[model samples]
Target: MWELIQSNRRKSLILFFGMGALLILIGYVFGSYYDPEAGGVVGVFFAIVLWVILSALSYFAGSKILLAVSGAKEVTKDVHPQLYNVVEEMKIAAGVPFFPKIYIIDDPAPNAFATGVKPENSAIAVTSGLLSTLNRYELQGVVAHEMSHIVNRDILLMTFAGVMLGVITIMSDIFFRGMYFGGGSRYRSRSSSKSSGQAQVIVMILAIILAILGPVLAQLFYFAISRKREYLADASAARLTRYPEGLANALEKIANSTHKLRSANKVTAPMYIVNPLKREGMKLADLTSTHPPISERIKILRALQQGVSYNDYQRVFEMIHGKKEKIIPDSVLKESIAVTPVIGLTNEDKDFNPIEARREANDAVMKLNDYNFINCKCGVKIKIPPDYNKPIVVCPRCGTRHQLR
Candidate 1:
């Protein structure tokens, strides 16, 4: 695991520097369109400053922003006992130093993601749809997958990459709009000679080309990195849970689902277990996909016939993908960590009903919104919405009065 983290950090640094170089180059290109001599230098400076600020935000406050944008509400173990319990089990199995805070998204899409700068300070969020859809074993698999991302530092890497993509998109948009409104008009007219004017035209053409292609190229980089890490996380999940079928089945359910995540954006798509934007039968994502093909992933998981170790996952992964390169390093294999026994479900997991699951998810969300609950003597529970401004509520079933305040 330490080797994986070290390798991940090394690769992350490369990715950040690579994207940052693109950012600076794009800045310089656009700047030259305005001030051919000095604007390029100014643009380089500006790009550096922008990258620094975004990196800072991404490290410190990015998770909060992502959760807010996704409409995630933090909750206690009481919201869904089995979910908490399963998460707890996986946390122990993975040996995460601290319990990741739990969050619930209100969307009905059955997808989940993890977020933090590191594993020690992290949170995992799932949709209400996931709660209602997945069985206990499947839920554990999804949790383990996200937990793998935390342990692998995939969240941090993806966060930085997403921010880079965002910066590129923003810069490209500004460049296009500037061109559309004749922003570079002063360039040619200010040229002192015909050669200088030609150079300006070339610079303008180059700027336009970059503006058109920057985001596309950046996305290719972003998605390429995203797709690879999903495989790693999937492998890690299998190793942690020692139950490949659980994640395989869970992925099947998620992939076959027709509902696209309502709150998902391009930046957040990579964080989800599956591609959040695409539904079944959409354009098959090639290199630009955030996650690997769900079918391929499920196949690799189910193909782990040898064993449930990292070596086993790598063996099957290569056998399926037909690659000689190793996904699991030789050092990781040497650890020779034996698979731990699987954690059996508790009575709470056994007794879980889909209808009850949905209700529990809804109640958890409402609690976040300040909804009040009261139990009546007649064995009826009263749920009062947050906007219920009245001071008292009468239970419909028991005709009992409950104080709101």
Candidate 2:
């Protein structure tokens, strides 16, 4: 698991530098077209600054934006006591400082995901269907897998990669817009006095080609980074739980489920435990995918369950998937595999009402829709429908009336 972390960290840095280089190159070329030496200097600076600002924003706010776009609502222990307990226990096992917020989506699809800038600010969300369908052990396996993502900071790496991709896309758009809008007019005016029309045509042709290829190259880079992170997260999860079968079972269940999550779309699809954008008749190995095939992931986990070491797992993964596993150190692997004691149910549990638990889950889902309150200011908690959109809601806490934004 440590190896996965180190490898992804290295990859993230490489991508950052690669993106910086691309931006600098584009800036220099465009700048030189206007003023040979001075323009190149200015362009490099502009590119660096633009990349830095955008990267920072993505690092801090990307996960929040993703959650909002996916329509996830936060929940508390009172709302989803089992889920909160599971996540909290995993957080302790991972030895992270802050526990990730828990969230529930109304979809019937059995799926879940983890997201945040870092473990401290992270969150784990699951579909209502997942909670209803998965048994306790199976649910622990799923939560543990997502917690692994938090520990390894995969979310941060993904966010950074996304930022770089965004930068490249924006740069490409600017290049194209400049070309189409006659940004070269001043250069043309100056060059026309000293050069032939053929030279001018050559410059425009080269500029147009660069404009078109820039975004394409950026997209390829984005796809490559996204795919790699998914693989790394899978390996990390397996190492963390030390019970690959648990996660494997969860994946199998997700694959078998037919319900599609209503809120999922192309942009937020990659963040899901399963590809929520169900593609009918599509096999797992199709080239156009943000996630690896579920079958492939299960195959790898099953192999791990048979006493395979991390190195051996990597070898098998590469043989089957054609991608190298990031080399994780023994110490990190041991640390990640560490588990906390499970809270065993006692005979006293019989005193608690199962019907009440069901009611709580239902009410929580309903409260989520009426308002996004995970915790109330009045100290009393409430749950609502996932799709409820009333303008006013009475807080169960203190009976205060709160207006929806």
Best by lDDT: 1
Residue 26: error of model 2 in Å? 2.3
lDDT over C-alpha atoms for residue 350 of model 1: 65
Give the local distance difference test score of model 1: 0.84
Candidate 2 off by > 4 Å: 1-4, 31-46, 183-185, 193-206, 278-287, 322-361, 367-405
Candidate 1, 207-262: lDDT as tens digits: 88988899999999988888888888998999888888889888998887777788
lDDT, candidate 2, residue 115? 92
Question: Pairs clashing in candidate 2?
Answer: 3-327, 3-328, 363-383, 365-384, 366-384, 366-385, 367-383, 367-384, 367-385
Per-candidate RMSD, Å:
3.7, 7.2
For each candidate, what is the lDDT? 0.84, 0.69
